[model samples]
Target: MKGPVSALGINLLGNNVEAAQTVIWTHPKKTEDIGYNFTTTKTITREELNKISKYIDDKDTSANVLAGIATTILTTPLKPYLSISSGIGVTLLTSYRSTNGKLVSDKLKKSTAKSFKVKIAYKYRQTGSNDGYYFIDTIKIS
Candidate 1:
């Protein structure tokens, strides 16, 4: 009987291998998700008014005190663009009203002690890539 001629009998090949398939997943974007606009109200207190008056009379050039007050009173996702300006504006408006006899000061002579409410409207404005800031749309005091 004749058999296959081989010094060492071993199979060199078997089956072919398949390559892996890649799949990527992503979420859909909505128009509303891109930005937001809203309005909020805050009531001013006598103590806050006193602080603003003190800061104004002291002529705080850095506006840090005003910024702090703005951050607390204004409603925004992050630091508002007009935080410092808003604080100073409100203080000046209150002072003007007091001077013009529109708003009367309390015993402590604090114009802001009149206990007025502020209504603020904010709109998100985009500046750079995926970056934005909230800008004041309107502000009303009553």
Candidate 2:
């Protein structure tokens, strides 16, 4: 397997291997058959979102335009925690509204308790002989 790392990035609960897809690899002879090797890596890690969230949330007000999306796909705990580590320039969007409407950008700046929907997008690249990075997003507050 001298190709890309083919790593798995996941937000887990407790330390159960069956709980999340941490890493998967294709069977040697069965090139097309993929299998998850939970025996190698098994640990549910947490993520840092205070800075990232505030940054993105704030961008919702400005012209920077947040790039990632919140997801209901993986559930951990209420304000559990989030961890994300991937190739540079990964798109992260967690906004209340789709990129639509003309309700005025300035108004978005001075608003509080702005509920947002979840959207997740990323840009990956396999440059040189380096393997791409993995990311895990969790909620850790409450």
Candidate 3:
């Protein structure tokens, strides 16, 4: 059994499908201010893990770290945001992306010593796949 410390944290971060379609979708100059939402202290199920493993297996590669996983309703021109929102108490940074090109991943830098204020960026999916979402690199508390 996994301990409470091992529970998976999932954050929706942000959904910008509408924003990106309009002229108001101003790209952030810093890449950190893109509209994103966040969540922490989540639990990952075995089925989810299996799915992830299969995805990796199909790619013939292995990964030791992942931010999070999400799904969307569209296949193209979709932008999803995933972030920890603040850098408070972040200790490490690791990232991995699905080879299928359906997942967007990010990791914080090891130098992250403060809570994340909020990181924003556009998440584009595969050319013809309907996978859109940003996974958190880590969990941060303010």
Best by TM-score: 1
Name the top lDDT candidate.
1
Error of 2 at 100 (Å): 19
Sort by lDDT, best first.
1, 2, 3
lDDT of 3: 0.27
Higher-lDDT candidate among 1 and 2? 1
Off by over 4 Å in 2: 1-104, 110-114, 118-120, 134-142
Model 1 residue pairs with clashes: none
- Model 3 is weakest, by summed lDDT over 10 consecutive residues, at 85-94
TM-score for each predicted model, relative to the true structure:
0.38, 0.22, 0.23
RMSD for each model, in Å, please? 26.7, 15.5, 16.7
Q: List candidate 3 segments past 4 Å from native.
A: 1-26, 29-42, 60-69, 72-142
Give Cα-based local distance difference scores for all models: 0.42, 0.28, 0.27
Q: Against the correct fold, how does model 2 do in TM-score? A: 0.22
lDDT measured at residue 13 in model 2 versus the true structure, 0 to 100: 61
Residue-level error in angstroms, candidate 1, position 96: 17
Instruction: Please say which candidate is ahead in TM-score: 2 or 3.
Output: 3
